[model samples]
Target: MKQGIQAFISYTYTKNDVWLITMKDMMQWVKNPIENSHLTKGYWICQFNDKIKCSEQTSNSTTKKVTFAAIINVDQIWIWQTAFLVVLYIVIYRYDKYMQEKKKK
Candidate 1:
């Protein structure tokens, strides 16, 4: 029987929003100790609110094993966009109120 390596990556878009990635039985050669070492291992782009993509290769030697894990922190752009929408709603409500008052006069 042979032992396998497991790795995981977890990150938050905001204080509440979180995303996770996990790889089981991964090769040991691609292991990284950093929290968000996306560029260190290979050429890959990670986008916020997008599905994660992964690639790995194992060594020819069967004795040694390796694994890699990374967690990326994305900006809370969704939270900001929600706030802006709320402000716009308030402005529209106020405008409607002003128009109603003018028509009564």
Candidate 2:
């Protein structure tokens, strides 16, 4: 019975220790988008060790770090894209009209 119970507990409980580091924190490490290939339209999961294993005594000390575990949904992408297109069209239209007026002058 004890062995069966232990198996049941193990099956029922699973732990996934994933840490989420915001975009702001990531910017510190990677300044340019061209440099880092994983910073494109996604939610990233970063995992780091709780404590330093070695006595490096440096400002940067971590065991592990993971990034870009998930990407933004298609619906979100469509919405943002639609908004951007609308704004871009408005700007272009206004600029064109301004240019036409200047040409007349």
Candidate 3:
């Protein structure tokens, strides 16, 4: 609740394209859109293989839906959390104000 612990993940995905991507250093937890400094933590479980040399659909991308599990980790980076919260509140406050003004118009 007072820290952020984002995981490190990377992978390549392609639908009908012929190029491979190497996603690297993907931070797990992300700040809420309305908040800048407030850090959050989340987990995602899916199929990944570093040895996917061949460019094949990792999981039937053409299908209507895919099955994957999500798990949130309880680990928190205390220092970051505090910083995130401070910034988040400021942003949220401003965003709320903006929304109220838009409604009045």
Candidate 4:
């Protein structure tokens, strides 16, 4: 059971001590220049980090931090795609039911 569970939620930190539930945290960590330079080695992650690093100065204000967080949220493509799939499923299910009812009438 432990192995099975780990297979699904296996994303880990540098130390392997901390377990993260979302990719957003990983994305944020990858963007940090000092904290985890090793992670930026990946081509895609590096590109994403470069794109999201909107501000030049390292010391960002509260508003800038919030904006950065929002940008990260938006950049999480899988989350948006999953949400769209769920909505599409619901619409298709409802439409199927409506069609069945119309056929009965």
TM-score of candidate 4 on Cα atoms, chains taken together: 0.30
The reply for model 3, stretches above 4 Å from the true place, is 1-76
Error of 2 at 95 (Å): 0.7
TM-score of 2: 0.30
Q: Write the per-residue lDDT of candidate 1 for residues 11-65, one digit (tens) a residue.
A: 3322444444444211221232223233122222333232222333233333212
| Candidate 4 lDDT trough over 10 residues, lowest sum | 1-10
Over 1-105, each residue of candidate 4 has an lDDT whose tens digit, in order, gives 111111011223335443322334344443443353322221111112312321112232321111111122444545544543443344335445555665699
Best by the lDDT measure: 1
lDDT for model 3, please. 0.31
Q: Which sequence of candidate numbers ranks them by TM-score, best first?
A: 4, 2, 1, 3
lDDT of each: 0.34, 0.32, 0.31, 0.31
Question: Candidate 4: how many backbone clashes?
Answer: 0
TM-score of each predicted structure versus truth = 0.29, 0.30, 0.29, 0.30
The runs of at least 3 residues in candidate 4 whose Cα sits more than 4 Å from the true structure, single-residue gaps closed, are: 1-74
| Candidate 2 per-residue lDDT over residues 15-78, each given as its tens digit | 4444444434344324433343332221222221321111112233342232222233343545
Per-residue accuracy of model 3 over 1-105 as CA lDDT, tens digit each: 532233222232235323211111112112232242222112222332321111112245542221221122344334444443443355445546655665699
- Alpha carbon lDDT of residue 44, candidate 1? 24
Q: How does residue 60 of candidate 4 score in lDDT?
A: 25
